[model samples]
Target: MRFFWSTLSAIFVKDIVTELRSRQVLPTMIVLGMLIVWVLRMASEAILTSKAVMGPVALWISFLFSGLLVQERSFAAEQQHDCIYGLLLAPIDQGTIYLSKLLANTAMLCIFEIIIVPVVLVAFRLGPDTRWPALAGVLLLGNIGISSVGTLFSAVVRVSRARSSLLSVLVLVVLMPMMIPATFALLTVFGAVPETLQGTGALSFIGSFNAAVGYMIAFDAVFVVACWLLFGFAIKE
Candidate 1:
Protein backbone atom coordinates (compact mmCIF):
# COMPACT_ATOMS: atom_id res chain seq x y z
CA MET A 1 0.00 0.00 0.00
CA ARG A 2 2.67 2.44 1.00
CA PHE A 3 4.72 1.60 -2.08
CA PHE A 4 1.76 2.21 -4.35
CA TRP A 5 1.00 5.55 -2.72
CA SER A 6 4.60 6.66 -2.84
CA THR A 7 5.03 5.60 -6.45
CA LEU A 8 1.83 7.35 -7.42
CA SER A 9 2.90 10.50 -5.60
CA ALA A 10 6.33 10.39 -7.20
CA ILE A 11 4.89 10.07 -10.69
CA PHE A 12 2.29 12.75 -10.04
CA VAL A 13 4.92 15.13 -8.72
CA LYS A 14 7.21 14.38 -11.63
CA ASP A 15 4.44 15.18 -14.10
CA ILE A 16 3.52 18.39 -12.31
CA VAL A 17 7.10 19.60 -12.20
CA THR A 18 7.79 18.61 -15.79
CA GLU A 19 4.58 20.29 -16.97
CA LEU A 20 5.43 23.42 -15.03
CA ARG A 21 8.91 23.51 -16.50
CA SER A 22 7.51 23.07 -20.00
CA ARG A 23 4.50 25.36 -19.41
CA GLN A 24 3.02 24.45 -22.75
CA VAL A 25 -0.11 22.46 -21.91
CA LEU A 26 -1.93 24.70 -19.45
CA PRO A 27 -1.36 28.01 -21.22
CA THR A 28 -2.39 26.71 -24.62
CA MET A 29 -5.50 25.13 -23.15
CA ILE A 30 -6.47 28.35 -21.34
CA VAL A 31 -6.00 30.48 -24.42
CA LEU A 32 -7.91 28.05 -26.60
CA GLY A 33 -10.68 27.78 -24.03
CA MET A 34 -10.95 31.57 -23.85
CA LEU A 35 -11.10 31.86 -27.63
CA ILE A 36 -13.77 29.19 -27.84
CA VAL A 37 -15.96 30.84 -25.23
CA TRP A 38 -15.45 34.26 -26.80
CA VAL A 39 -16.34 32.99 -30.23
CA LEU A 40 -19.42 31.18 -28.97
CA ARG A 41 -20.54 34.21 -27.01
CA MET A 42 -20.13 36.43 -30.04
CA ALA A 43 -22.12 34.03 -32.18
CA SER A 44 -24.91 33.72 -29.60
CA GLU A 45 -25.06 37.48 -29.01
CA ALA A 46 -26.52 37.96 -32.47
CA ILE A 47 -29.22 35.40 -31.66
CA LEU A 48 -32.40 35.71 -29.55
CA THR A 49 -32.85 37.03 -26.04
CA SER A 50 -32.03 35.12 -22.82
CA LYS A 51 -28.71 33.70 -23.91
CA ALA A 52 -28.95 31.23 -21.06
CA VAL A 53 -28.45 27.86 -22.71
CA MET A 54 -25.23 28.73 -24.47
CA GLY A 55 -23.40 29.12 -21.18
CA PRO A 56 -23.12 25.43 -20.30
CA VAL A 57 -22.69 24.34 -23.88
CA ALA A 58 -19.82 26.75 -24.33
CA LEU A 59 -18.06 25.49 -21.21
CA TRP A 60 -18.53 21.83 -22.11
CA ILE A 61 -17.32 22.34 -25.67
CA SER A 62 -14.28 24.24 -24.51
CA PHE A 63 -13.58 21.61 -21.88
CA LEU A 64 -13.84 18.80 -24.40
CA PHE A 65 -11.20 20.33 -26.63
CA SER A 66 -9.03 21.29 -23.71
CA GLY A 67 -9.16 17.71 -22.47
CA LEU A 68 -8.12 16.38 -25.86
CA LEU A 69 -5.17 18.72 -25.83
CA VAL A 70 -4.03 17.46 -22.46
CA GLN A 71 -4.62 13.81 -23.30
CA GLU A 72 -2.64 14.14 -26.50
CA ARG A 73 0.35 15.30 -24.53
CA SER A 74 0.00 12.51 -21.99
CA PHE A 75 1.68 9.98 -24.26
CA ALA A 76 3.55 12.44 -26.43
CA ALA A 77 5.62 13.46 -23.45
CA GLU A 78 6.62 9.87 -22.73
CA GLN A 79 7.40 9.25 -26.36
CA GLN A 80 9.81 12.19 -26.48
CA HIS A 81 12.92 10.59 -24.97
CA ASP A 82 11.64 7.03 -24.98
CA CYS A 83 10.84 7.65 -21.33
CA ILE A 84 7.88 5.41 -21.96
CA TYR A 85 10.20 2.45 -22.13
CA GLY A 86 11.97 3.62 -19.02
CA LEU A 87 8.67 3.84 -17.17
CA LEU A 88 7.72 0.43 -18.39
CA LEU A 89 11.05 -0.91 -17.13
CA ALA A 90 10.37 0.47 -13.70
CA PRO A 91 9.35 -1.93 -10.93
CA ILE A 92 5.71 -0.97 -10.97
CA ASP A 93 2.45 -2.61 -11.80
CA GLN A 94 0.65 -1.77 -15.03
CA GLY A 95 -2.35 -0.53 -13.10
CA THR A 96 -0.19 1.98 -11.30
CA ILE A 97 0.91 3.45 -14.59
CA TYR A 98 -2.68 3.86 -15.72
CA LEU A 99 -3.71 5.44 -12.41
CA SER A 100 -0.79 7.85 -12.45
CA LYS A 101 -1.49 8.93 -15.99
CA LEU A 102 -5.18 9.30 -15.23
CA LEU A 103 -4.40 11.39 -12.16
CA ALA A 104 -2.16 13.73 -14.12
CA ASN A 105 -4.73 14.10 -16.87
CA THR A 106 -7.53 14.74 -14.37
CA ALA A 107 -5.40 17.34 -12.63
CA MET A 108 -4.83 19.11 -15.91
CA LEU A 109 -8.54 19.02 -16.70
CA CYS A 110 -9.36 20.54 -13.30
CA ILE A 111 -6.85 23.32 -13.83
CA PHE A 112 -8.36 24.09 -17.22
CA GLU A 113 -11.80 24.10 -15.67
CA ILE A 114 -10.65 26.45 -12.92
CA ILE A 115 -9.52 29.00 -15.46
CA ILE A 116 -12.14 28.34 -18.14
CA VAL A 117 -15.20 28.42 -15.90
CA PRO A 118 -14.57 31.95 -14.66
CA VAL A 119 -13.84 33.23 -18.13
CA VAL A 120 -16.97 31.50 -19.37
CA LEU A 121 -19.08 33.13 -16.66
CA VAL A 122 -17.69 36.62 -17.22
CA ALA A 123 -17.88 36.43 -20.99
CA PHE A 124 -21.31 34.78 -21.18
CA ARG A 125 -22.97 36.54 -18.21
CA LEU A 126 -23.50 33.38 -16.16
CA GLY A 127 -23.32 34.16 -12.51
CA PRO A 128 -22.52 31.81 -9.65
CA ASP A 129 -26.23 31.16 -9.53
CA THR A 130 -28.34 28.66 -11.48
CA ARG A 131 -27.07 25.26 -10.42
CA TRP A 132 -23.39 25.91 -10.94
CA PRO A 133 -22.42 23.36 -8.31
CA ALA A 134 -24.53 20.65 -9.88
CA LEU A 135 -23.10 21.45 -13.26
CA ALA A 136 -19.63 21.17 -11.82
CA GLY A 137 -20.36 17.79 -10.28
CA VAL A 138 -21.54 16.37 -13.56
CA LEU A 139 -18.53 17.79 -15.33
CA LEU A 140 -16.19 16.17 -12.82
CA LEU A 141 -17.86 12.79 -13.11
CA GLY A 142 -17.99 12.89 -16.89
CA ASN A 143 -14.37 13.96 -17.17
CA ILE A 144 -13.33 11.01 -15.01
CA GLY A 145 -14.96 8.72 -17.54
CA ILE A 146 -13.47 10.68 -20.42
CA SER A 147 -9.93 10.88 -19.07
CA SER A 148 -9.90 7.17 -18.20
CA VAL A 149 -10.81 5.99 -21.68
CA GLY A 150 -8.70 8.73 -23.18
CA THR A 151 -5.57 7.75 -21.28
CA LEU A 152 -5.82 4.26 -22.71
CA PHE A 153 -6.54 5.36 -26.27
CA SER A 154 -3.86 8.03 -26.24
CA ALA A 155 -1.22 5.51 -25.25
CA VAL A 156 -2.49 3.10 -27.85
CA VAL A 157 -2.32 5.67 -30.62
CA ARG A 158 1.09 6.94 -29.58
CA VAL A 159 2.54 3.67 -30.85
CA SER A 160 0.76 3.95 -34.19
CA ARG A 161 2.04 5.85 -37.23
CA ALA A 162 -1.06 8.11 -37.52
CA ARG A 163 -0.68 9.55 -33.97
CA SER A 164 -2.74 12.68 -33.33
CA SER A 165 -5.47 12.70 -35.96
CA LEU A 166 -6.12 9.00 -35.64
CA LEU A 167 -6.34 9.18 -31.88
CA SER A 168 -8.77 12.06 -32.13
CA VAL A 169 -11.09 10.18 -34.48
CA LEU A 170 -11.01 6.94 -32.53
CA VAL A 171 -11.54 8.54 -29.14
CA LEU A 172 -14.32 10.79 -30.39
CA VAL A 173 -16.09 7.82 -31.94
CA VAL A 174 -15.89 5.82 -28.73
CA LEU A 175 -17.08 8.82 -26.74
CA MET A 176 -20.35 9.25 -28.62
CA PRO A 177 -22.32 7.13 -26.18
CA MET A 178 -21.14 9.35 -23.34
CA MET A 179 -22.47 12.49 -25.01
CA ILE A 180 -26.05 11.93 -23.89
CA PRO A 181 -25.43 11.94 -20.14
CA ALA A 182 -23.00 14.79 -20.41
CA THR A 183 -25.32 16.84 -22.58
CA PHE A 184 -28.31 16.07 -20.43
CA ALA A 185 -26.48 17.11 -17.28
CA LEU A 186 -25.22 20.28 -18.90
CA LEU A 187 -28.57 21.12 -20.45
CA THR A 188 -30.39 20.56 -17.23
CA VAL A 189 -28.08 22.95 -15.45
CA PHE A 190 -27.77 25.60 -18.12
CA GLY A 191 -30.64 25.02 -20.53
CA ALA A 192 -33.45 27.53 -21.01
CA VAL A 193 -35.75 24.80 -19.70
CA PRO A 194 -34.27 22.97 -16.75
CA GLU A 195 -35.53 19.61 -15.51
CA THR A 196 -36.80 19.16 -12.01
CA LEU A 197 -36.00 16.30 -9.64
CA GLN A 198 -39.64 15.94 -8.47
CA GLY A 199 -41.53 13.85 -10.99
CA THR A 200 -41.14 10.10 -11.61
CA GLY A 201 -38.76 10.40 -14.53
CA ALA A 202 -37.83 14.00 -14.01
CA LEU A 203 -34.40 13.56 -12.49
CA SER A 204 -34.23 9.84 -13.30
CA PHE A 205 -32.62 10.48 -16.62
CA ILE A 206 -29.68 12.30 -15.14
CA GLY A 207 -29.53 9.87 -12.24
CA SER A 208 -29.51 6.90 -14.56
CA PHE A 209 -26.90 8.53 -16.71
CA ASN A 210 -24.73 9.18 -13.70
CA ALA A 211 -25.16 5.65 -12.37
CA ALA A 212 -24.48 4.04 -15.69
CA VAL A 213 -21.36 6.09 -16.24
CA GLY A 214 -20.25 5.49 -12.70
CA TYR A 215 -20.35 1.73 -13.22
CA MET A 216 -18.58 2.11 -16.52
CA ILE A 217 -15.69 3.81 -14.74
CA ALA A 218 -14.69 0.47 -13.30
CA PHE A 219 -15.01 -1.14 -16.68
CA ASP A 220 -12.95 1.64 -18.20
CA ALA A 221 -10.36 1.25 -15.47
CA VAL A 222 -10.09 -2.45 -16.18
CA PHE A 223 -9.75 -1.84 -19.89
CA VAL A 224 -6.95 0.64 -19.29
CA VAL A 225 -5.22 -1.93 -17.12
CA ALA A 226 -5.56 -4.53 -19.82
CA CYS A 227 -4.16 -2.12 -22.40
CA TRP A 228 -1.24 -1.21 -20.18
CA LEU A 229 -0.46 -4.89 -19.77
CA LEU A 230 -0.72 -5.48 -23.49
CA PHE A 231 0.77 -2.29 -24.96
CA GLY A 232 4.32 -3.50 -24.38
CA PHE A 233 3.60 -6.52 -26.57
CA ALA A 234 2.31 -4.26 -29.34
CA ILE A 235 4.98 -1.56 -29.11
CA LYS A 236 8.47 -3.02 -29.03
CA GLU A 237 11.88 -1.42 -29.10
Candidate 2:
Protein backbone atom coordinates (compact mmCIF):
# COMPACT_ATOMS: atom_id res chain seq x y z
CA MET A 1 0.00 0.00 0.00
CA ARG A 2 2.80 2.37 0.88
CA PHE A 3 4.60 1.55 -2.35
CA PHE A 4 1.47 2.25 -4.37
CA TRP A 5 0.93 5.57 -2.68
CA SER A 6 4.57 6.53 -3.02
CA THR A 7 4.52 5.70 -6.72
CA LEU A 8 1.32 7.69 -7.12
CA SER A 9 2.89 10.69 -5.41
CA ALA A 10 5.99 10.49 -7.58
CA ILE A 11 3.95 10.43 -10.78
CA PHE A 12 1.71 13.20 -9.52
CA VAL A 13 4.73 15.38 -8.75
CA LYS A 14 6.27 14.54 -12.10
CA ASP A 15 3.15 15.70 -13.91
CA ILE A 16 2.82 18.87 -11.86
CA VAL A 17 6.47 19.81 -12.35
CA THR A 18 6.38 19.07 -16.05
CA GLU A 19 3.22 21.17 -16.43
CA LEU A 20 4.71 24.09 -14.50
CA ARG A 21 7.84 24.02 -16.66
CA SER A 22 5.90 23.81 -19.90
CA ARG A 23 3.42 26.46 -18.80
CA GLN A 24 1.06 25.04 -21.35
CA VAL A 25 -2.25 23.79 -19.92
CA LEU A 26 -2.80 26.45 -17.25
CA PRO A 27 -2.33 29.35 -19.63
CA THR A 28 -4.72 27.85 -22.14
CA MET A 29 -7.32 27.09 -19.49
CA ILE A 30 -7.12 30.62 -18.17
CA VAL A 31 -7.17 32.19 -21.59
CA LEU A 32 -9.91 30.05 -23.00
CA GLY A 33 -12.08 30.44 -19.90
CA MET A 34 -11.70 34.22 -19.89
CA LEU A 35 -12.27 34.58 -23.59
CA ILE A 36 -15.39 32.49 -23.55
CA VAL A 37 -16.94 34.35 -20.63
CA TRP A 38 -16.06 37.73 -22.06
CA VAL A 39 -17.46 36.83 -25.43
CA LEU A 40 -20.64 35.45 -23.97
CA ARG A 41 -21.09 38.48 -21.78
CA MET A 42 -20.58 40.79 -24.72
CA ALA A 43 -23.00 38.83 -26.84
CA SER A 44 -25.66 39.10 -24.17
CA GLU A 45 -25.08 42.77 -23.42
CA ALA A 46 -27.87 43.87 -25.75
CA ILE A 47 -30.43 42.12 -23.55
CA LEU A 48 -31.37 44.69 -20.97
CA THR A 49 -32.97 42.45 -18.35
CA SER A 50 -31.51 39.58 -16.33
CA LYS A 51 -28.51 37.49 -17.32
CA ALA A 52 -29.48 35.32 -14.38
CA VAL A 53 -29.48 31.95 -16.13
CA MET A 54 -26.83 32.70 -18.70
CA GLY A 55 -24.21 33.45 -16.07
CA PRO A 56 -23.74 29.99 -14.64
CA VAL A 57 -24.43 28.37 -17.98
CA ALA A 58 -21.72 30.44 -19.60
CA LEU A 59 -19.30 29.70 -16.79
CA TRP A 60 -19.77 25.96 -17.14
CA ILE A 61 -19.53 26.07 -20.92
CA SER A 62 -16.18 27.72 -20.59
CA PHE A 63 -15.12 25.19 -17.98
CA LEU A 64 -16.18 22.25 -20.12
CA PHE A 65 -14.47 23.47 -23.27
CA SER A 66 -11.25 24.49 -21.54
CA GLY A 67 -11.22 21.29 -19.49
CA LEU A 68 -11.53 19.10 -22.59
CA LEU A 69 -8.65 20.84 -24.29
CA VAL A 70 -6.51 20.66 -21.18
CA GLN A 71 -7.18 16.95 -20.74
CA GLU A 72 -6.01 16.30 -24.28
CA ARG A 73 -3.00 18.45 -23.65
CA SER A 74 -2.26 16.51 -20.47
CA PHE A 75 -1.42 13.42 -22.51
CA ALA A 76 0.05 15.45 -25.30
CA ALA A 77 2.54 16.89 -22.86
CA GLU A 78 3.58 13.36 -21.98
CA GLN A 79 4.28 12.70 -25.65
CA GLN A 80 6.91 15.40 -25.93
CA HIS A 81 9.72 13.17 -24.66
CA ASP A 82 7.84 9.92 -24.31
CA CYS A 83 7.60 10.61 -20.61
CA ILE A 84 4.62 8.30 -20.40
CA TYR A 85 6.84 5.53 -21.78
CA GLY A 86 9.23 5.93 -18.90
CA LEU A 87 6.34 5.80 -16.46
CA LEU A 88 4.98 2.71 -18.13
CA LEU A 89 8.34 0.97 -17.75
CA ALA A 90 8.38 1.73 -14.04
CA PRO A 91 7.15 -1.07 -11.76
CA ILE A 92 4.17 1.02 -10.67
CA ASP A 93 0.72 -0.47 -10.54
CA GLN A 94 -1.55 0.49 -13.44
CA GLY A 95 -4.18 1.62 -10.95
CA THR A 96 -1.60 3.83 -9.30
CA ILE A 97 -0.81 5.39 -12.64
CA TYR A 98 -4.49 6.11 -13.30
CA LEU A 99 -4.92 7.61 -9.85
CA SER A 100 -1.84 9.77 -10.26
CA LYS A 101 -3.16 11.11 -13.52
CA LEU A 102 -6.57 11.72 -11.94
CA LEU A 103 -5.03 13.61 -9.04
CA ALA A 104 -2.86 15.69 -11.36
CA ASN A 105 -5.84 16.50 -13.56
CA THR A 106 -7.91 17.41 -10.53
CA ALA A 107 -5.19 19.74 -9.32
CA MET A 108 -5.01 21.44 -12.67
CA LEU A 109 -8.79 21.74 -12.84
CA CYS A 110 -8.92 23.23 -9.34
CA ILE A 111 -6.41 25.89 -10.28
CA PHE A 112 -8.35 26.65 -13.42
CA GLU A 113 -11.51 26.99 -11.35
CA ILE A 114 -9.76 29.33 -8.92
CA ILE A 115 -9.06 31.73 -11.74
CA ILE A 116 -12.29 31.18 -13.62
CA VAL A 117 -14.65 31.35 -10.64
CA PRO A 118 -13.85 34.97 -9.82
CA VAL A 119 -14.11 35.86 -13.47
CA VAL A 120 -17.46 34.15 -13.54
CA LEU A 121 -18.69 35.96 -10.43
CA VAL A 122 -17.53 39.35 -11.62
CA ALA A 123 -18.82 38.84 -15.11
CA PHE A 124 -22.20 37.62 -13.89
CA ARG A 125 -22.44 40.30 -11.21
CA LEU A 126 -22.72 37.54 -8.62
CA GLY A 127 -19.96 38.74 -6.31
CA PRO A 128 -21.42 40.76 -3.47
CA ASP A 129 -24.07 38.45 -2.04
CA THR A 130 -22.38 35.17 -2.89
CA ARG A 131 -20.95 32.72 -0.41
CA TRP A 132 -17.37 32.23 -1.61
CA PRO A 133 -16.56 29.16 0.44
CA ALA A 134 -19.77 27.35 -0.46
CA LEU A 135 -19.35 28.22 -4.10
CA ALA A 136 -15.81 26.89 -4.04
CA GLY A 137 -16.89 23.67 -2.42
CA VAL A 138 -19.63 23.11 -5.00
CA LEU A 139 -17.36 23.83 -7.91
CA LEU A 140 -14.75 21.45 -6.52
CA LEU A 141 -17.25 18.61 -6.37
CA GLY A 142 -18.41 19.25 -9.92
CA ASN A 143 -14.85 19.43 -11.19
CA ILE A 144 -13.96 16.19 -9.47
CA GLY A 145 -16.57 14.41 -11.54
CA ILE A 146 -15.43 16.25 -14.65
CA SER A 147 -11.68 15.84 -14.29
CA SER A 148 -11.86 12.28 -13.05
CA VAL A 149 -13.95 11.20 -16.01
CA GLY A 150 -12.02 13.38 -18.42
CA THR A 151 -8.67 12.03 -17.28
CA LEU A 152 -9.91 8.53 -17.89
CA PHE A 153 -11.25 9.35 -21.34
CA SER A 154 -8.13 11.29 -22.13
CA ALA A 155 -6.07 8.20 -21.34
CA VAL A 156 -8.43 5.99 -23.29
CA VAL A 157 -8.03 8.09 -26.37
CA ARG A 158 -4.48 9.18 -25.65
CA VAL A 159 -2.76 8.29 -28.87
CA SER A 160 -5.56 8.66 -31.38
CA ARG A 161 -5.03 10.80 -34.44
CA ALA A 162 -8.47 12.31 -34.04
CA ARG A 163 -8.30 12.53 -30.30
CA SER A 164 -9.77 15.98 -29.89
CA SER A 165 -12.96 15.30 -31.81
CA LEU A 166 -13.40 11.82 -30.42
CA LEU A 167 -12.79 12.87 -26.86
CA SER A 168 -15.05 15.90 -27.16
CA VAL A 169 -17.85 13.70 -28.48
CA LEU A 170 -17.42 10.99 -25.91
CA VAL A 171 -16.91 13.28 -22.94
CA LEU A 172 -19.77 15.55 -23.84
CA VAL A 173 -22.10 12.64 -24.46
CA VAL A 174 -21.39 11.08 -21.11
CA LEU A 175 -21.28 14.32 -19.17
CA MET A 176 -24.15 16.21 -20.69
CA PRO A 177 -26.61 14.22 -18.64
CA MET A 178 -24.66 15.20 -15.59
CA MET A 179 -25.11 18.86 -16.41
CA ILE A 180 -28.80 18.83 -15.37
CA PRO A 181 -27.90 17.87 -11.84
CA ALA A 182 -24.78 20.03 -11.89
CA THR A 183 -26.47 23.14 -13.25
CA PHE A 184 -29.31 22.90 -10.79
CA ALA A 185 -26.84 22.26 -8.01
CA LEU A 186 -24.77 25.29 -9.00
CA LEU A 187 -27.83 27.44 -9.39
CA THR A 188 -29.09 26.37 -6.00
CA VAL A 189 -25.72 26.82 -4.34
CA PHE A 190 -25.19 30.23 -5.92
CA GLY A 191 -28.73 31.17 -4.97
CA ALA A 192 -29.34 32.26 -8.54
CA VAL A 193 -32.60 30.35 -8.43
CA PRO A 194 -34.91 29.19 -5.66
CA GLU A 195 -34.13 26.07 -3.68
CA THR A 196 -34.98 22.79 -5.41
CA LEU A 197 -35.23 20.45 -2.46
CA GLN A 198 -38.96 19.94 -2.89
CA GLY A 199 -38.46 17.24 -5.51
CA THR A 200 -35.10 16.46 -7.07
CA GLY A 201 -35.53 12.70 -6.98
CA ALA A 202 -33.81 12.26 -3.61
CA LEU A 203 -30.63 14.34 -4.09
CA SER A 204 -31.40 17.96 -3.30
CA PHE A 205 -28.91 20.77 -3.71
CA ILE A 206 -31.46 23.08 -2.11
CA GLY A 207 -31.68 21.45 1.29
CA SER A 208 -28.47 19.47 1.22
CA PHE A 209 -25.38 20.64 -0.62
CA ASN A 210 -23.44 17.84 1.04
CA ALA A 211 -25.67 15.31 -0.66
CA ALA A 212 -24.86 16.87 -4.02
CA VAL A 213 -21.17 16.86 -3.23
CA GLY A 214 -21.30 13.27 -2.11
CA TYR A 215 -23.18 12.31 -5.25
CA MET A 216 -20.50 13.75 -7.46
CA ILE A 217 -17.82 12.17 -5.31
CA ALA A 218 -19.48 8.81 -5.77
CA PHE A 219 -19.76 9.39 -9.48
CA ASP A 220 -16.07 10.21 -9.75
CA ALA A 221 -15.02 7.34 -7.55
CA VAL A 222 -16.88 4.77 -9.61
CA PHE A 223 -15.37 5.99 -12.86
CA VAL A 224 -11.92 6.37 -11.36
CA VAL A 225 -11.93 2.82 -10.04
CA ALA A 226 -13.20 1.48 -13.35
CA CYS A 227 -10.56 3.39 -15.27
CA TRP A 228 -7.85 2.36 -12.87
CA LEU A 229 -8.79 -1.26 -13.40
CA LEU A 230 -9.04 -0.94 -17.18
CA PHE A 231 -6.09 1.39 -17.81
CA GLY A 232 -3.64 -1.41 -18.47
CA PHE A 233 -5.74 -2.62 -21.38
CA ALA A 234 -5.96 0.94 -22.68
CA ILE A 235 -2.18 1.23 -22.60
CA LYS A 236 -1.71 -2.06 -24.39
CA GLU A 237 -4.18 -1.05 -27.08
Q: Which one wins on TM-score? A: 2
- For model 2, the stretches where C-alpha displacement exceeds 4 angstroms are 47-49, 128-130, 197-214
TM-score of predicted structure 1: 0.83
lDDT value for model 2: 0.77
Give the per-residue lDDT digits (tens) of candidate 2, residues 1-237. 899888989889988998899797799889999999998888778775356666777778987888898788767677668887887888877778878888888899888988887887788786525567766766777787778678878877878889989989988888865666677667766666665466655335324545555566677668767777887887653
> Would you list the C-alpha lDDT of every candidate in the order shown?
0.75, 0.77
Candidate 1: the clashing residue pairs are none
Tell me the TM-score of each prediction against the true structure.
Answer: 0.83, 0.88
Writing each residue's lDDT as its tens digit, candidate 1 over 76-164 gives 88998899888889988767777788889988898888888888778877764666677677777767767876777788778777787
Clashing pairs in 2: none
Best by lDDT: 2
